[model samples]
Target: MKKTLMILLATILVMLTGCGTENKSGGLEISKDVAFGEKDYEKIVSPANELGFKLLKEVEADENNNIFISPTSLFMALAMVYNGAEGETKEEIAQVLHSEGIDPEELNKANASMMSVLNKEADDIQLNIANSIWLNDKFTFQKDFAGSNKDYFNAEIAEIDIADSKSPEQINNWVKEATNDKIEKIVDSPLDANLVAVLINAIYFKGSWTNEFDKNETEDRPFQLLDGSFKDVPLMAMKEKFSYLENEKFQAITLPYGDGEMSMKVFLPKENSSLEEFKTLLTHENWTAWQKEFEVEKGTILLPKFQLEFEASLKGALKSLGMKSAFDENANFTKMINEDDQVSITNVKQKTFIDVGEKGTEAAAVTGIEMGITSAPINEPFRMEVNRPFFFTITDEETDTILFMGSISNPVQAK
Candidate 1:
């Protein structure tokens, strides 16, 4: 079996605004035709949560920096790639994804089912997911690999001249359109002539708060940073009933969005506990325990009106999470193409944007795994104030899948 050089790009945009509806622009659309058994649903959700925390830990190594990530976007792109992997390369990817025991075919079915569920339209919210494959016209890809993606992921197939100057634009345009123009470009530079194919996934989510925050209540307030310095930022205030929890270490609250189909959960560490310390306790076990701890309560909530944009190379993070062979020369991706060409990943990059204000939250993220590759809210009433750094996650309540998550150390800084 020969290694396949692969480059994957994934983007996610979550927009929180006032009640309104917008039509999505152009992209390849997939029909809801895939199905999965009950076991498949279990296979999908468990590993997704595990990967969520694992990736979170890797990215949060920088204690003082603000961090945001879309594990779903990254997983979907790689899951498509996993369909084309065999042997040790496949094993490594599986371990990293925490899908070690599950059969790859079964995993694909689970993902397809999950995607269908997530793409279901609701009147109050818009969650759109689009996928595509751009292949170099010169190379002949395996039919089975291509067909699986189309059938399972609803990925559109296109043949492009990789050497042409317009190639990157074609791929980035798909990204821009899928992300509602929030992310204009995923490829900042031209592709290498030797590059064969680029697999891309984009998810866009826009929804209004179940109870929109009153813009009139927003006021400039002092936000304490991790370093003891403070910056004056617009703090959006509200007094509403919410699912709330408080323990010795932190206080948490869940704010619903779009008829309670989705929510933002916020975790504010106690003044005595450092954010870093709280993060150590954020495992899957702890998260489930915390969820079980929530209760209905009424209290005042004060959150900052902040916006952030972040970009980073994720090669180190994925490698640290046991996806090492895919990046090394010894890697093998024989299932990608029938030819004997050896392929290894070259780079992986991610970019994300987020804005939180009186209306809601808007966030976007793009992950480019070149085989190059590889790849919240919260609330609180009970007088909870997000005056200091905290952790938050925006999730699909029905499926319990986390869409976007981050930690805010300073609202004014946008790195």
Candidate 2:
């Protein structure tokens, strides 16, 4: 009886934890606990960060608001959606996502492994990533598509009655909870009639500066804007030994958070050059080079304390990244559902919030990919798919993007 009870208890524990499960779907058996260490993390940095840099330029191409984005959140959400993508749609997404040369199974495991490693949170800082898929209760989606994301991304799958007036709130509430109320809502009050599924990824982070600034030392300082104008802002002050870099175009520094496990890199464009000009120089090669240029030096840093909440539709940006097919009404998402039902991404939007203050920094982001009913073209498999000095980013590696996938925030563009 005792032995039987122990076995029963163990089974119950597995059920509750949602871990150590065998993930087999679409002819691939994925390992739940895939290995992703510093070296593995480094190998994928170029591809992972390449998209974020390009997307940032595209997002800011329209207007210069205090820009902030979570490449990880956006990538994870799209990666889930990619499972159902096929044909040209899949290839475009793969190119834009920098997933070339990586097979489907490997992509799933890499995302899963990276997220798992990041979630091994420490006591001093908090970083959380949540993914989910909400299917229209009336819609029929591919079981394998749903299962792949569930197994690899650890997504919470649900069926929502779109007719229900409270359904939008239900989805928003998850965003609220996932972001610790930092983000209150993601979906609109009246859900779209064409909407079939919404794939979402939310990230919340709060961390204290390793070399914290003195609250009392904060003073009003003149800060430069991208337009060459100056505004008086409350600037936080800290003097200490830190990694500092100097280039002809910009000067940069690193601000570690939570025992140096992660950090925010800050860059300031040289007086002769403007933030606008420096932004144009943000190539993948430059990012890699900039990461290595930082040498430890004793310096006093003055940083402005600001907050920004920005939201925008990423349809344009995604399309700009050569992912136009997925957004088309005739997009081939056959792997996600029957071709007759037809589904494609009608909208890809993101909402991000950040507050940098004396005690610490708090930020949240939510990316929602809205799918609508369509007649998809049939084919093979599933599909899916930066800073300013005057920039700040928190990533696992300057090259590899670890901090919940790479995060870029440049509130310094304060108008």
Candidate 3:
């Protein structure tokens, strides 16, 4: 694990981190067909938690999240499309996504996308032609923002000239009226929209702990930081066995979200107990090893109650992750938006918010494929031992997108 220190405001803090792909030779499969299967969604969700952990470290100096996605929505949208898509279109869509650096073999190995991937992390989500038309057009919704083409004020909608009697104001107003506020502008100016289309994904999760953490035992415990310091932070502790695993690199614990459908897993390194050392060991193989060892058993746990937030521009990140062609204006999105002609994704933007307090966790996220696309404090007694560095993430068992990614070493500073 490599380490970097970023100085924000007046405080300097150390940061450590981690990506994803296939399951060959230890790599997790990332293909749409096989992506949902093989627990690829779990694979993706795991790293996201690592990202959250990293952000928690950085935010110890500031109060801004740095990653984004709506896990539940992303999963639901993927589920809808998975069940909705059939025959050639389904296979074609799968291939396109797989070609963008995912494993095609896994996709081919599975039959129904819903059967295998629903409740699993999905790499790509799709909607049927009917659903897209109904939600994006026929349905009435508020528009986000609008203005004349000449004045150029609306950030999302620009260049629509109001010269034809309507003026920018009316033109903008129409957009505001059409989207029902789900979309703010027609054209994200500077960026042009050749044609109009909509892409929506939804995810829902209900997971319960194999063993619930006892609120009665929650208490503030000292959280160790990378700088060799400790702060008294509340940790939610419960004495019950869970699916626990330990390897030469780190100690691991798996806590199911609500139903058995979703879960949150944490990984902490041993010996050096540093983020860098643990990150170097966070690989598909290591993940596979941990998964193989996971067993439904009894155990004790002490987790921190903290909230986290993150927002990021994912265009560059997606491009770097291998979907370069999709970013091209000439790329193929016919299957995605259900158009005869290909539509390109001009911009992608995303935002996420999470809160994990004493009364369970509440999270909300929005990803605009501009595209586009928590915390806690404890005062009560009962020990919530979230000391040392740990990982956290939000995931949908359906689509394989890691909606939000982060970590926390010092929960007190994790704004």
Candidate 4:
């Protein structure tokens, strides 16, 4: 759970084109250029970094050892909204999916069929909630097999039931299972299940620190928080060469994962800095420019070891970014999920948990189970000394997008 507060902020939806073959239906078709632009993806990742988190890595894969989100989460979340949406909002959704080269009609039909079974089974559940505020109706989805697995999060199903299904419970079960009994319930108050969205990313990552801090040399340290408070933190002190970056915006440090390929970068604002002001200046362009400054150099690195927890509704944040139409009850979503009944997207609730230690990293996230991978071996020693007040981030080795970001000011109360 501590890892989540620091890792939950990084994410990017990729643009995937020509995933598979041509369309069989006369409906809209997604093209080969359907992925989100690199710049846009980066835009989402940078802030998480500035906010004080670490992005480990992000990839698409399926396996038991890997993390998995029930396909029902995606299906159910969308269905709830579809049950409430109508006109222009719906059309816009369809257009986005269609422009991506997906068959809007086909996806809608599939969603409708699934909704029928779900609605019938949960007849006692009231679903009058409007979705125009969450999703547009016109949104279309790619229909090809390749299209199914092209997005950052997998939307297709391998084996599952839509109706007469007990997906809501499954979501809860997944939470317990992933957290090892630590997080017993991700969604409290079943009656308050206003909306749900689930996303799962499982990875086995190992990276060595640029400079290994001697465990015997570790000691207690102080970490500062945005509230002007400080706490005793375990500091891993080391002096070695590493990829470091310093600029007017912030002073940055990089801590490599178990393998030297991926690293976690920490950015510390100058003392007496306005945390809010520093955050506002964060952007994709600045991150790009700053990253280029990373170079190996010798210096004293003090990092604090701590765990933290935080929860907030992202609907408003996402809406401020131009995704409003999809949440309106009167929106058009015919291009996305088509059923004989009205449809739209309602709420988007996400819960994340993570644990990072000297051994490895484990994390779980849900977008809407009602809605919603792996690699590698390490032969070299990963050297990272995290023992002071600092911000960290994780990123894909190939794409610089921040996968997760957060701070370790007061490790004890972070959760």
Predicted structure 1: lDDT: 0.75
Separately for all candidates shown, the number of backbone clashes (residues 3 or more apart, or on different chains) is 17, 11, 86, 111
Please say which candidate is ahead in lDDT: 1 or 2.
Answer: 1
Error of 4 at 8 (Å): 18
Worst 10 residues of 1 by lDDT: 372-381
Number of the top lDDT candidate: 1
Off by over 4 Å in 1: 1-6, 16-21, 25-35, 60-64, 188-191, 372-415
Question: By TM-score, how accurate is candidate 1?
Answer: 0.83
lDDT of 3 by residue, 93-155 (tens): 333233222332232233223323542332221111101111223122123111110011111
lDDT per residue as tens, model 2, 157-249 = 788887788988998887666655555676787876655666665544556777677889999999877676889999999889999999899
Candidate 1 lDDT by residue in tens digits, 1-415: 2333455656454563544445364333444564566345566676778787878778743344888777776777678778778888899889878889667678788887776667636666777777788888887778878887887777888998877889899988887677667777766457776567777776767777788788899899998898889989898889999999999999988988888888889899999998889878978788878889899999988887788877777778889998888777667878877776666767777777788766667887777777632211244667778899999999999999999999989888666
Q: Give Cα-based local distance difference scores for all models.
A: 0.75, 0.66, 0.39, 0.38
What is the per-residue lDDT of model 4 for residues 25-97, given as tens digits with 9 covering 90 to 100? 1121223434433233232223333222111111122231122222233233332233223455544433322
TM-score, cand. 2: 0.77
In terms of lDDT, model 2 sits at: 0.66
Q: Which of the two candidates, 1 or 4, achieves a greater TM-score against the reference?
A: 1
| After superposition, candidate 3 runs with Cα above 4 Å error | 1-112, 115-195, 257-261, 295-299, 329-342, 357-360, 371-415
Ranking by lDDT: 1, 2, 3, 4
Best-matching candidate per TM-score: 1
TM-score ranking of the models: 1, 2, 4, 3
